[model samples]
Target chain A: MVAQIVFIIILLGAVYLFGKNVAKVRRNILLGRDTDRSDRPAERWAIMTKVALGQTKMVKRPIAAVMHFFIYVGFVIINLEVLEIMIDGIFGSHRIFSKPLGSLYGLLIGGFEVLALLVLVSCVVFLARRNILKLKRFSGTEMTAWPKSDANYILTIEILLMTAFLTMNAADYKLQLLHFGHYATAGSFPISGFIAPLLPSGPGALAGIERGCWWFHIIGILAFLNYLPYSKHFHILLAFPNVYYSNLKPKGEFTDMASVTNEVKAMLDPSFVPEPAEVSRFGVKDVTDLTWKNLMEAYTCTECGRCTSVCPANITGKLLSPRKIMMDTRDRLVEVGNNIDKHGKDYTDDKTLLDNYITREELWACTTCNACTEACPVNINPLEIITEMRRYVVMEESQAPASLNNMFGNMENNGAPWKYSQADRLNWAASDKVD
Target chain B: MEQKIPTMAEMAAEGNEPEILFWVGCAGSFDERAQKITRNICKILHHVGISYAVLGTEESCTGDPAKRAGNEFLFQMQAMVNIEVLNGYNIKKIVTGCPHCFNTIRNEYPGLGGTYEVIHHTQLIQGLIDEGKLKAEGGESFKGRKITFHDPCYLGRGNNVYEAPRAALEILDTELVEMKRCKSNGLCCGAGGAQMFKEPEKGNKDINDERMLDVIETGASVIASGCPFCMTMLTDGVKHMEKEQEIKVLDIAEITVRANGL
Candidate 1:
């Protein structure tokens, strides 16, 4: 009864904290400008199914895909065992489903055991890939101490949880063999049976080990759930919604600015009266100026660096790493969110996403090649943020590069990006043919 | 030799509309090297007997560079001016020799109310080959020489027109090769997003120099391109590496004209 009370208290505390963090994150994301992404429900659903649920893009790298497949499947399948553990914890019953389920319970637990082993092995390999092999993508400039440690911590936690689960079953299996009280012959432990021989052959020791593991597994999972909202691992939940609202237009299309359109219309027409509205900013200088979709994209970034690895500018040793763009956005957003939490919703920090986190060199180095967008597993568009920041720099601040200023001037006056006159447009046709 | 390319004004005066409007972009009009590509595009249209009219003085910038360079006000102004002229003519079909012009007019112009059937010149040549209007049988033979196609970011990943350009080249007698990063994975030529007009930001190496390594890896003697900007960058890349004698950077239309004897 005392154990059940403690379990209930811990579970509720974890749930409440997790709920608070989720609410904070949602509020942070909604702080951005409004844009409708509710159109074409059927198409969005199809894409969500293919990209997030099916993990189709993950398979682009076959080795990592296969390993990730193991971990993902294991995480899902092992949740069934977690359900059993939850019930057992609440009722203070040992394997309560054993009587009703009988043979089927053994089969299911046996399958979960196999998956737990795979999850354990995969996590170790992932850890080694990060720490041992030191994959270039994982050790990017943006992946400082905290991000790197966060990844290592998650992998280590998973490894420990899987170990506990298997060992718990092994201890339980031994207790059942001795026909101990409440330790009914329920689960068929194919893996734990191998481990059973190694454990101490004593009933009291076995019971303590089983109970200790049960508490550890449940508590670890609850802690992991709470950890997700504050970590890059938040992608596990956000990837679905992020991909559903993907920009389905042709990659070449840059969205026309309505503010610019209204201004241009008034300039072009003598009789036209522009709509009286709030003084609209040209583009995103900070998170608040960005669309909600862009904010959600920042939250959904996995920091996998698939984007940075394929970036043309980053490939040539340029300052523009697409992964870093997403990281900086998220970091700045988190800071803004913290400020809001402490100083109320209308708080201002005077620092923007531009100049503080992302540099001008990084912004200009981008070729606007959509490689980052194509390479993102969750369909996050870093180019959108880069372009929006560029717009703010040029239109709001009037700080465009000298060469680009020349090009704009020529386009304004000569009707082209050069000093040549529009009257000479037909000169190419009249010129002598090259042999 | 003068080619007498008819202007939209002349076509309208004759109470007729050409089959397509040849959008002579700024580079095609002014740049000395890009002018040769513009002439070949006109030659191909004339040889295939497809009636096309140039917008001539009426054509203005499509605002691709300005928009990309973060100057939205200038871009929209340029777009509106071009849209007004294009809508005034009621142009139904348009073709462009430059991928930047092709992409901007096709995708961006429609939102600004300048809708038309826009296609890159490579796609037009591919269609001609498909319909048996053009053949590579009679022109300069590249049978023994190795050729490779550099997918322009605008036309390939930007618009998903990867196959059309390759189809135009596949019709040739030359052996076609591929860079390791081709199609959707093609690297930028350090020329898009108004980067052509400006020097690149400080980096370990220029993007074109890095891309040239990919070209060199393929060991292709002839690099076929579809964008004027890409042509300039690749040609400069060849000079940068001093492989001008070993490698020739030719526009896809230029290659088409050489192969089809147009």
Candidate 2:
């Protein structure tokens, strides 16, 4: 009875902590401006089905895709086992499902064992890709310290959790064979039975080992749930909603600025004097200026570096990595969130997302080709952020590159980007043909 | 050589409304190489007997480069001016040989109150073929030859105009072959997003040079494109590769004129 009380308390405490962290992340994302993405329902459903549930974009890289699919599918399937574990923890019962479900429980256990092994193998491959292969996209300055370490840490934890589950199953199987009290002779441990011989032989030894593995696995899982909000692994929970709320317009369309449209509206109508609305800012200066969708996109990034890998600027040795752009936005937003949390609502940070995190050189390097947005498996639009910053630099600060200045000057003076006047526009028609 | 091209001002003074207004973009107006593409488009229009007048002196840049270069204010100023002139003439149903101008007019101009039925020259030429108005007479120059159409970014990926240019090319007797990256996946000619106005940042290679390799590998002697900016970049690329004499980079309008013996 004491053990049951202790188990319930610990489980509830972990659940409360996990819930708190998730709320903290939710609050941080809500710090940005509002953006209405509720227009299209049928389109969003189709995209969510293809991207998150169907894993359509994942298969672009076949070998890695299959490995990731194994782990992804396996993890989802094994989550059922976790529900059973959590129920057992609450009621102080062992293998409760075995009695009610009968022989079906053995089949489920066998499937879980096979899936756990697959997950372990895939985790090993992921570790190898990150550590051994040192893929160029994964080795850049953006991925230098904590992000890289965080990746390895998550993979290691997953590896440990899978190992513990297998070992615990194996020990329990051995104990059952010895006719121990309350040790049900159920659960076909196909892969873990191999571990039975490796464990020490006596019922007390096996019981101790089994209980240790079980406790460690459950504790590690709870810790992992809490850790997700702080890591890129949060994409596991966020991908579905992120892809579902994607911008459904044609990829070629650039949305007109609401302020620009309003200003244009006033210009077109000569009759009514418009109200002096808050002098609207042209473009984003920081995370507060970006839409909630943009903030959510930054949060959903898996740090897979797929966007950076295919980025023309990064591939051509330019400073702009679309993945890094997303990272900097998230970092700056987190900084602002922390400041506001500590110092009420009036807190201000000395740095902004423009020059403090992402540089002018990085912004200028982008070709705005939509490659990064297209390449994103979860539909993150790093280009939108880049363009918004460029808008700030040009409209708010009136600072643009020299050549662009020349182009803008000509556009203002002569209705064209070139110095030649519109008077000579038709000169080509009257000019002698070279041929 | 003076073709007596009617301006919108002239057509309006005579109380005439043209079926379409030709928006001669900056490149088509001033650039020497692009002038030929402008001429071919005009010839095809005249041959089809479609009443089209140019903005001429009234025609100015579409402010596409300014908008793309992050000068929204300048872009709006220029767009409003052009919209005034176009609206003053009460013109509608415009066509242009440049995809940049087509994209800006079709997609961007409506926000500033300048809306019209904008058609690309390739699409116009494709329509004329379908209408049985402009027929391709084989053996003029490019009969029984392999001709590859380079999809302009603004026309292809930018506005979902992949089929019209290819359909226009189908009117010719030339065999059509595709590069490794063509159509929606077509590589840029290093010119979109105002990149044409500035030098590329230091890299191992130029985008146009890389795209040229795709063109060269296809073994198509005649490189056809639908945008004037693409013509200039790919022409420079062919010159850089020293394949100028062998591989001729012609606009799709130029091909249409050649095939029809216009």
Candidate 3:
């Protein structure tokens, strides 16, 4: 009865946490203003194939890739075991895993145990990679807050879960031995066979210990479920869908000027009125301006700093950092979310956060070359945001690189960006013979 | 009622039916050598049993450069007027030596309800060659002199025609070497998107200069291009780099005309 009460409390807490996260994510999806470019069926399948099934992006770093893949597969396969463990804990009947497929369940459990061990080993290597080896590739990258500590904590918890799993298996095997009244099958768990001799040889003690280990295993899994949302492990749940819906468009296609009227009309009418009211201007001035996918991109950033590594501006001694662009956007979103939470809908101080977080020069320095977006393992489209900001700078503020002003003027008068007269347009035809 | 612009399909349907609607784009009608090249293409078409007409001053800008510069309103207005004038002649199948005009009338005009089946002079010339309507006279190789093709953005990337011009070059006895970033990823000639009109942004390298260096690296004595803008910019780059005597810039039409012994 006490174990039942503890299990109920932990499960309820996990349910509440997961529900809250879902609600938050759903709100972002609905309210975020990104354009839906997922109309093509081929594109959807391609994204699923490349990102979800293939795990193409994550495997750029092989060690972490291997670790993450096993953990991911193990977590998925262990679901049945999790349900069986819960059912056994709630009822006195451990008949869930003891059915016709009992041997198959044992094999599955064994497979998961092996994978868990591999995952645990890989996690240690990752920790050593971050903390001890400290290669430059890992350094100055977007290391999460308390990443080392979090990794160590998650690793410890994983080891404990697996240890508890094996312990429960040992106890079950002993109970099976006691039930069948045979020492021949006792060798299945050699350590448990040794442990069986040390424990009370009666059925009552074995049953009590079995219930205790079941509670430990069930409670450990429930706690992991409850803690999933708040940790970096949240990516284990998020990255799959995030990768599956990754942008498949050519990099240059920016958010089609929501309405082309302002962009279209700005050409001929030298005195053309700027349509500030009807037109949705270019820059992502706030979180609301970002598309749901862009917001998702912020959340999905693993902070691997691959973007920062390939950013030409960053390499050429410029202040522009692509990693910081994602980080700042994420920080700003959280800041806004907190403000909204505290002050309700009247949160108006987001300007200071935007101004301090992203510099205008950094925004303008981007060449829209897509090198950073190409390099990013998470499929983050940083260039899209940069181009949108460029549009804002050019359209809303009437501010552009001074060179572009001359180009615009040439285009206005000569039908070309050059200052040459319109008469020169057909100069290339001089070599041809007219009828 | 406001005048209606004929679509490219409607225009292409009138091929060989009307006198050629000579599209004297802003460059060919104005620049001296470009006009000469245009005259040469017309002459070649005339010699090959194809009758053509010239729109002359009736032709207006295709508005490609303006559109590229994010000035779509002017582009529409210019396209509307050009469409009206072409429709006034009830003419279709507009021919142009300018790839920008070809691309604009062929690709972008449909957005403004002015679709036309536009073909570049090189494409038309290649057709003439394939149909046995035109024949080249040269078999002698221009030994020790190599030629390279500079792909104009509008002709190559914008419209996906990379082969016909090279085929013309092959007949000219010129050794064809490709630039590293030729065809789709080909560097711009510092002319498209109205870039020719304005100063290039502050970069250590010019796009045209970079492209010219690519051409020079191929050891080509002549750089061939379909678009006049590419011809002008590359010629200027070659000159600026003091390779003027060693290198020459020729339009694909000019080369084709010469190859056919026209």
Q: Evaluated with TM-score, which candidate comes out highest?
A: 1
Model 1: per-residue Cα lDDT over A1-435, one tens digit each: 999999899989999999999999999999888888899999999999999888888877888889888998999899988998999998898888888998999999999999999999999999999999999989778999999998998899999999999999999999999998889889899999999999999999999999999999999999999999889899989999999999988898887788788888899987878788668688888888888899999999978899999998898888899999999999999999999889988889889999999998898998888888888888999999999999999999999888889988999999999899988888777646555
Using alpha carbons, what is the TM-score of model 2?
0.91
Choose 1 or 2, whichever is better by lDDT: 1
What is the TM-score ranking, best to worst? 1, 2, 3
lDDT of 2 by residue, A1-435 (tens): 686787788888988998987787778888877778898799899999999888887776788789888888888999988988888888889988999989999999999999999999999989998899976767886996999998999899999999999999999999889989889798899999998899999899899999899889988898898889889999989999999999776555566665765565567666646666566578888888888899999889989998887666676677779999999998888888889889988888789998999998888777776667767888899988888888888889988888888888887777777788867887887747643
In candidate 3, how many Å is residue A120 off? Answer: 3.3
Candidate 3 local distance difference test against the native = 0.65
Misplaced by over 4 Å in model 3 are: A34-38, A41-46, A56-68, A92-95, A124-252, A262-283, A304-323, A350-354, A371-380, A432-435, B1-262
What is the two-chain DockQ of model 1?
Answer: 0.76
Q: Which regions of candidate 2 are displaced past 4 Å?
A: A175-179, A193-197, A264-272, B1-6, B10-16, B49-51, B88-92, B125-150, B170-177, B181-185, B216-222
Candidate number of the best DockQ: 1
Q: Compared with the true structure, what per-residue lDDT tens digits does model 3 show for residues B140-251?
A: 3455568888877667655677887877777655578898767655666766645555555444555566667788889888888888888888888887799988898988
Q: Give me the displacement of residue A279 in model 1, in angstroms.
A: 2.7
**Fnat of all models, as shown:** 0.79, 0.48, 0.10
Quick one: ranking by DockQ, best first? Answer: 1, 2, 3
Candidate 1 vs candidate 3, lDDT winner = 1
